[model samples]
Target: MTHHAYADRRSGSRTHADGRPPAPPPLPVAARRGPAGRRLLTGLFLVGLVASVLPWWLDTPAGSLTDATATTTAAGQITGLLAGYLLLVQVLMMSRLPVLERVVGGERIAAWHRDLGVTLLVAVLAHTAFILVGYGGLTGRSPWDQAGVMLREYQDLVSAFAAAGLLVLVGLTSVRAVRRALPYELWHATHLAGYAVLLLGFAHQFSNGTQLFRPGPVRTGWIVCYGLVVAALVWGRLVGPLTVNLRHRLRVADVVAESPDTVSIYLTGVRLDRLALLGGQFFRWRFLTRGCWWQSHPFSVSAAANGRWLRLTVKVVGAYTGDLRDLEPGVRVWAVGPSGTFTAAHRVRDRALLIAGGSGITPLRAMLEELPPGAALIYRARTPADVLLHRELDWLAQARGVRIWYVVGSRNDPGPRQVMSPDGLRRLVPDVARRDVYLCGPPGLVEQSRRLLRRIGVPRRQIHVGTFEL
Candidate 1:
């Protein structure tokens, strides 16, 4: 339907006849609690940092750093320790545990994973550089010759070198520019090489490192840290999905084209209610189809789950999504999520203002159906043709007393019609600042809207942002 048609349909919605929405719904009790997990995670990071350096400090003799060789060795040990700790942390951040995702949000976790990965690469490089220099200085040999000697003499030095090279490759591909240049499948596959790097690096550390080789509290602590990290990875990433897929046996029930480039896939499985997904949450779904089984793409639930049914609307953005339009019924599926914190559980106010861009409406559409009345949705699209699920929005407007505003105009229009700007936002939703805002979209739009929301007097704590970026 055209934007004008949708406008006319919603003209008589009359959710409230006073030219104002009703009083906002009261915020849920769970929403008022502060982010306890964030604080706890930060504390753990600090503790880990201290633990990482404590061994080197305790073992070093007084005035050890007075000698250049000792100083270089000490610095190398510090970098190695930090790199090892951070490598484990990178795994933990992406363990995909529901409790962690609920507490810290998936976006924050993914971002932390990327940041820590970059830092880990730098530390590993520094560790190599320092170790080469220190050993070369002590042995009166050139750095290049010392490197060959160490690799030939050390137990796991070859594996360590291989791990470092793999780490560098993964890190380079993860760069924003490099990632965008590659296909999602290629990038994702490249990213998974981190697990291999971790394995090789771990062997190198235990076999050659003096700190970990010593039987003491430091070694015990390293063992415990690695053990927990391995357990988390196994359960959260591997066994968790395997168990869920076996129990649920999710399969495609139907597929309906929602727009020229968008298709809504209906999934059904045994005991789907057990999944317990929130309204605006998403899953990394892998469809067991010939052309689509290799990679799982994250898509928000387009509608609330009803016992055995779940729906996700996907836009044709890349090869994976483009192939989804042709997906048939009865395809087996495996999912690894319900991850994110954009649901009503995170709301901080009674009134909610949901801002969506393009296909970002999927999750918000689900939220509109499940959220209490006194919520308003502002959907921004580049043109009338880009607006999706208008009929459903209007139906909700009439049935559930929720206001729906479809801002259909060219985003690139240089004039006054860019509804995403601060001025346009204020004009569209005069009471926006009073409502808790939930935003989901591309990175650029989400960041820009966040800034606009902040500038318009919306407190940072009251605005929740979700992104589609991996």
Candidate 2:
């Protein structure tokens, strides 16, 4: 394939020496709504929390805490309420809602989901403990015996216990080490049980909850909350994607090998002008082929949307990705996004510094087409042969007035170590602190670069990060 085939296509009418279009103008800063969206979401969550606990506060009188059993029961009620609310929060965060993804960004939502997962597990466990102990004290029996009695007598209690076990298993699998040890598909499939946990735990909340047992506004409100979360999940996960795929009718146009381990899949669809995509955004792609039809994976566009085609550069790191290399033209693709906030619209500064390791350059390569002039890119790879799209990057540098540095070496090599050091970064970029630093790569490289950037006086807020992790 010719180099021009991979060049930026967002250039409207302007043509360059190489016959490719010129880079487009940067997006306006006002286009980004992250800070305002974050505040709005936070306020809404706090309000919901207050509402969730209000019935408990009203029902329990001050004199009700006269005994150890009463106090324990009260604690159990509060913990159960919090856990229910938090479970909703966790699901909403990952629902892939367009508004949330556009305003708050997918990366931030994923981070929140990970942190809250831990808290949700703790709250659920605490609620179970408090209930067993409180009931045991009241019945003059051991907690274990009380658990058995409750399980035998209470309606939906068996399902609740099953939900608790499933939740615990999900939590254990989510641990970084465990998650890493498992295959991506297995880990992702395991996480799907979280929805089952919600379903199993639902009936118990209304059947047994002290504050929810009787029909009232409190119960109605909780039901409404559940309905809203379920609606969001359906729309975000199902309806929205179906609509986009049906409208676009995306099909694989071609697949070209960029390196021994990497290939770029070219996609074409109908009415591309209406796709409304930006550089650095990604889609969860599901190719409609026998072996690949069921699995959907997220991949960023390696080149800016040019109204006629979209490109995704992928490295074959696992079986799923390895399958992508063999996809033929004309195969239909179901895509779920055009998501992520790693675009020029989200930049905090006029000039940007992009640090890419391995295949992480894909999004950065696309972003260069929209960033304002004078942006700099540092591409890191273990060897020269490992670099992907060097020609395209070189062409972009001259066309967009970007400065390019290809850093090649082992992680322990002195040259790479110094170049990544605080002093080395300052010397190369000179005004690194004044620019927005966009980092993407392996976990270790991204973390190390972030530390060095901070040490060189770059504020944490100025650093934007992208990762392959879901």
Candidate 3:
């Protein structure tokens, strides 16, 4: 096998012909979240709330109605409006727009996406039930009969029912228990059905919704909202990766085993510095190799990108990742970007507290190299063998004068857990509460750490969490 010179080292800086480190990449514009973004989001929420009541306000009969039928119809209309708005919001979140991701961290966006998804599902159900009830009462028929009549009588209602059914299936699979049981590929494919679900909803609304039947600002607003969301989704999720891959011409240069189950895949590309990837951010990587090309997986940069090479350390937790161990050099790579907000740029406090567990060390390890002085790291692993990239981590600690604390032991051994506890943490880092803490680990550990940090007086905004698990 031919060796690649660029893959041999992991450093952030690149030397030019004159022997100086090349100029650093320009900082991303969205790095700072100011008043404008907050105000925009607030305005969106307020506008939706106002729109939910617009239909009733505009209809003269609705204002003077004093009957149960009118009340049911009004309830149905309001729920439908709110449901449509929420569904659109969820689509925007799914778009993976960089500006939004930077302003709101990837984790927060993901959390909101999940919450909004469930809420939208609930809203959709409420809209359907109420509408059926209202129509049934108006026509003097049972809701069941009305549902069948609506489905048969209206083309839009047929598509709406289909969309709702798909939404229900998607929601069921999204349940933690159900999602965990499904294979990643299967879950991903099922999730993509959400796009169709959203489109079907659009069709249903524009065709049947009373508020949007007539051409006006309300209809125009709905169309423009959906158009923008669809464009963002197409650009950010689809077109963006294709453009990046074509421009960078990335290919696997080498694969180095870090542990029995973990390997670092090195990629080389042209003018890679232009990717603007900070340490601690990750990309959804798709290796165009037989058996693994179909599924893309998220992995953090194990080191800073230096234009010559990019690195991602992944563990063999499943079949797809396990195959990565055998991935040969020269395989083309497709990537979807330098995402996540867990970086040195977000650090506000003078001192920094970096925490990692298992493979979670990938991003935090990169962060250690980029973070300034006064930063400390707490690495937790089942054993010394499980601690990845110790050689580089130790070198960074000694060279930079940063403190490294390794909490090594299995769960069966009390040492690791004890060290992570509030008392133990306080003992390890005396001024922990005053520091800006960056944590990357399992959900359970991260949650526990956040709780401990909160109890120990660390402000919520001062603690940032990054998860490797997508």
Candidate 4:
């Protein structure tokens, strides 16, 4: 459908029954209420910031839920909801990243995304309150009696434990100060703990939840959903990597370092195409015979899908990718994907706003060739040197109806940050509010562009960004 028709169909969609516009229906819980949400707590935080400034919710006093037992019950429900929802959100975010890039417009889904995140957060907090109330019956002397009561009856002990574990895992990651101070490798390992917490939560629900444990279809349905989520995470996060390692893979191809620490690797192995990848997808390639599986990292494909050879342009970021420039042409490398589905195909908007920062420019370079006409690009790089695909981008810009903006930040002795935040894109583009904006790159750039767009009155329905570059 045309943009106008599509928007009309999706809007409150008031039907004229004998010439009167009907009131909008209540928001559906199953559907995503917004186009998309921020990743994990990050999206929650951005929305939270937005929420704090507005009187969106009803008036509730500081101790509105002051009743001790009531408060505990409310907290328990909220916590339960949060843990389950976050797990689902993280999995969805990671899995959708690759394909989401292919689509042109994400803002259309913005409402659903925002609503899901908010609802889930509230559920978790409520879940926590409920659990607290349940446990309040236990004094120091009555701990065993509470335990006996829990054990004697088919209560949700397992789920409660799972809820506690999920909370702990989410809580630890929630602390930005702690997460940032830890090395990437360390943080990554610790984050995997969520998988275990989720598994326990699933078991707890089956054992405790009144709805989930019922006989026949009701129980089976929840079991299936819980199983699918855990299975997807295992396949995407851990098992996929292990399977690649077990296959005894070969590197097969290597790149001629275009610059220091940056080189392209042409990978060839058994059934590479069968790896099920799209043009802008990525992989966590592990080249071993040495270190650990914990070191494998994600890299985006700099080239489009050709079906014959899988290609990647990687710059040495730290430990794993740092040594990538020197990889032997014939060395053995375990490739764990054709993963992530971010491309421009998912867009309904013909005209687009494409933004990129630092290494983030690589994936966009691949997407640019595939982008339909009338697409605008704003690329941020430090000086002319750090601009990775200048030649390719410029060539695409030469295509009719394409606009390109290169923001160079540093003036003298340069660094990546010299061009990091391309605030200049805001001033240069006067009509930005009309287009759907897709951003990839540093967090600062993505965050800034979004804020700038909002300040200029672009509907929240038109701005989009992924949680991470990959």
Quote each prediction's TM-score: 0.90, 0.94, 0.91, 0.63
What is every candidate's alpha-carbon RMSD to the true fold? 5.3, 2.7, 3.9, 14.7
Strongest candidate by TM-score: 2
Query: If both were scored by lDDT, which would come out higher, candidate 1 or candidate 2?
Result: 2
**CA lDDT, every prediction?**
0.80, 0.87, 0.80, 0.54
| Candidate 2 C-alpha lDDT tens digits along 1-470 | 32233433445321223655455434433335336667898899899888878889988887879999989988899999999999999998888999988887777788889999999999999999999999899989999999999999996999999999999999999999999999888989999999998899999999999999999998998999999999999999999988998899999877877788888888889988798788888999999999999999999999876788889999999899999998988999999888888887788778999999999999998888888879999999998878988877888788789999999999899989889987888889999999999999999999999989988899887899988877
List, residue by residue over 1-470, the lDDT tens digit for candidate 3.
Answer: 22222223643332212323333332322334333664687687778768756765775463555788777877888888888778778878778887777666566777888888888889889888888898899999999999999888899888789899999999999998999999877888998899888878778787888788878887897788788888999888888777888899899977877887888887888888787787888888899997988888888998876777889998888888889988898999998877887887777676789888899999987777677766899988878889888767766776556799988887557887787788888999999999989988877778878998999999988898897655
lDDT by residue for model 1 over 1-470, one digit each (tens)?
11122221113231323333332322222453366768888998999888898888888878768888978988889999999999988888878876787778787799888888888999999999999999899999888998999988986999899999999999999989999899877888888888888888887777778788878888888989989998998888989888988989999876777778888887878997687777788999999988888778889998765565788988998777888888788999999887887787778677789989899999998877666677888888877878887777766786667888877665577542456778878887888998889998766668878988989899988898878876
Best by lDDT: 2
- Superposed model 4: Cα runs more than 4 Å off: 1-166, 201-217, 230-252, 269-279, 336-342, 398-405, 411-434, 455-459, 466-470
- Which of candidates 2 and 3 reaches a greater TM-score? 2
- Candidate 4 lDDT over residue span 306-404, tens digit each: 444556767777766766655666767776655543555434355568878777776666666566667788787665666775654555576435688
Comparing candidate 3 with candidate 4, which one achieves the higher TM-score? 3
Q: Looking at candidate 2, what is the lDDT of residue 288? A: 96
